[model samples]
Target: MVCGLLRPDAGSVHVTGRPVSTAAGPAKQLIGFVPQDVALYPDLSVRENLRFFGRLYRLPRRRLERRVDEVLDLVDLASRADDRVESLSGGMRRRLNIGAGLVHSPTLLVLDEPTVGVDPQSRHAILESVTRFGEEGMAVLYTTHYMEEAERLCDRVGIIDRGRLIAEGGPRELVQLVAERDRVRLTAVGDLSAYAEACRRLPRVEGVARGGDRGDVVELVVKDARSLLPDLLDLAHQQAVGIRSVEIDEPDLEAVFLHLTGTALRE
Candidate 1:
């Protein structure tokens, strides 16, 4: 929708105070979209790519050159302006893709998984660019399956599943929605399913999930984990479960995702 390639089926998309469906050109001009795949012409040089995209937006030659330089500097790709896209590293190509999007000075930037398969260093660089965009007052609609990325980059987040938004709030606010204040993980042996079912029936246990081979490991979310550990152990003992180890994990976005969907985010 932001790129004018797709239209909403029912709802509306707004860009810079103008409705997108009605004011396609003006509204689209305010948006810059960087998709998961790099869209640069591999045959073109970095500067050539920027100049081509800039001209498409009808920016004046002088303004386009200046804007290209500014964005190149912003993305730290100024030194590679004359280099062909294929000559650059994966990280550099990703940076160039980001730089190309900003050449027209769009008010809104939509990045969809910009760091999908880059090296760690390149991924870090891309994240920094996004942070800088927000710092520079650019409204960015960034979408990713990576929870840590969302936690690091977004002031607010909207979690979508199956084409519908399931949760929308600050990270801290969403984590608070789960009733469990704390979580405890236990690795035990012998019929863990029975132990898990028993734990689920316990009063303080808010949720219980079985994992590991033969369901030997279980994660329990509870209102008061520290106090409930004793009762949890007792319940396991009654089922003849042999406790091997125990660990407590802090509640985080993964927990929030699990609580909302009744399945782990990875699943």
Candidate 2:
């Protein structure tokens, strides 16, 4: 909606003070949107794909050529300028998708899960480029399922669930909302449901559930995990649960999500 790709049912959308919903097309010039899927020509060369998009923005020839090279450098694809999109690896193609949107240098960049299917190296490169974009004065609205990415990149975050905006604030500010609690995960082998119920009755343990693909991990939200460690171990022993590992985490965005929505984010 912010990118003017979809119409908001109620309120109007705006970018750089321009009304995105009401404006015909000019408002979009101030924004660059890169969707989760790659958008590029398979047969086109890396530099060619960029030039094509730049020309659509009506960039002058000289400036278009210069911007193409600059974008390649920024996306770490300078050496693959002549490689066809189909010939590139999945990660490399993802980089070009981002570069295509950045050709005209819009003031607002909206990336919707830009690293969803890319390799780790490409994901890191994309995150680094986004940091550089903010450093260079571009406002970036990044959306992702990765909690750590949100914690690491965003200055402000708006969490949406069931098609509604439930929360919005700086990452630290949101995390501080749940600072009194801790997220704890215990890996063990036993009757998980009974163990989870047992943990819930323990003092300072606010919530408990069985998680993990095999439901072998007991997850809990506690006031202070360190103080309750001994008690948790005693309960596990009584329940005949063989503890394999334990992790106590400080409150973070995932905890904030579970606090607000009563469930984990779909990873």
Candidate 3:
């Protein structure tokens, strides 16, 4: 809305109680956005990129240089400050992008999939930086498809699907919606679909899902797995299923997603 890129047809977007459509300078100055794609001039060095963004905010010359150095150090890219954007690796470039966003010290930082394709090292660094910003009391609206990342980074997560927010809560609270006390996974041979149907009818079983190829592996959520094991095996046997291996897994976010959506998160 600030750049005339996205506009609300009916509703409105407000920043700091001021409407974003009309409040460009003041509202825009208070918010920093880090897009999913890296947006840096390939020809410019990291320091030069940060300086250019700082000048856009009309930062004082002396203070702007200090802020640039501070942000570079914050992202652990101070050593590579003079390196051209084209020469840096994917992770380094992502860090520079984050650094550029923080140059103006905005109160709110909106990060859109900031760690989409970076290596584990870079991803870890970016997450750490965001955590640090939160610790410093910066309000952040981070959006991503990775549930684990959201669980790890956000204090409260808003789960959006098809442009609608389906669920919003603390990670633990969301996981509790699945009604899963524990999970039991069985690897077997035979008619799994029939066996899964039988498990679904069981009083102890809360949910059932096919795991791997041939539907050989099946995971079940139940109230008490220890007491239900014998009955489950008996059901499999009744269906002419041969159990090869069995393992119990604890419930996590994936189970919650499955329970709420009736589909596996991986799918």
* Overall lDDT per candidate, in order of appearance: 0.83, 0.88, 0.82
Best of the two (1, 3) by TM-score: 1
Give the range of the ten consecutive residues with the poorest summed lDDT in model 3. Answer: 258-267
Ranking by TM-score: 2, 1, 3
Off by over 4 Å in 3: 1-4, 22-25, 179-247
Better of 1 and 2 by lDDT: 2
TM-score of each: 0.81, 0.89, 0.78
Q: Pairing residues by index, what is the TM-score of model 3?
A: 0.78
Choose the strongest candidate by TM-score. Answer: 2
lDDT of 1 by residue, 159-203 (tens): 877778899999889877864567678999988878888888888
Candidate 2 lDDT over residue span 1-267, tens digit each: 888777889898777678896445788888887989998999999999999999888899999999999999988899999988899999999999999999999999999999897889999999999998999999999999888999999999999988899999999999988899999899999887888888888888876766789878887878888899999999999999889999999999988887677565854
| lDDT tens digits, residue span 1-267, model 3 | 533247767777666775665434567777787888999999999999999998888899999999999998998888988989999999999999888889999888888889888999999989998998999999888877677788888888876656666888988888777545777889999988889888989987777888776658888877778999999999988989999999887776656655555454544
As for candidate 1, its clashing pairs are none
Instruction: State in Å the error of residue 41, model 1.
Output: 0.7
User: In order, what is each prediction's RMSD in angstroms?
Assistant: 3.8, 2.4, 3.9
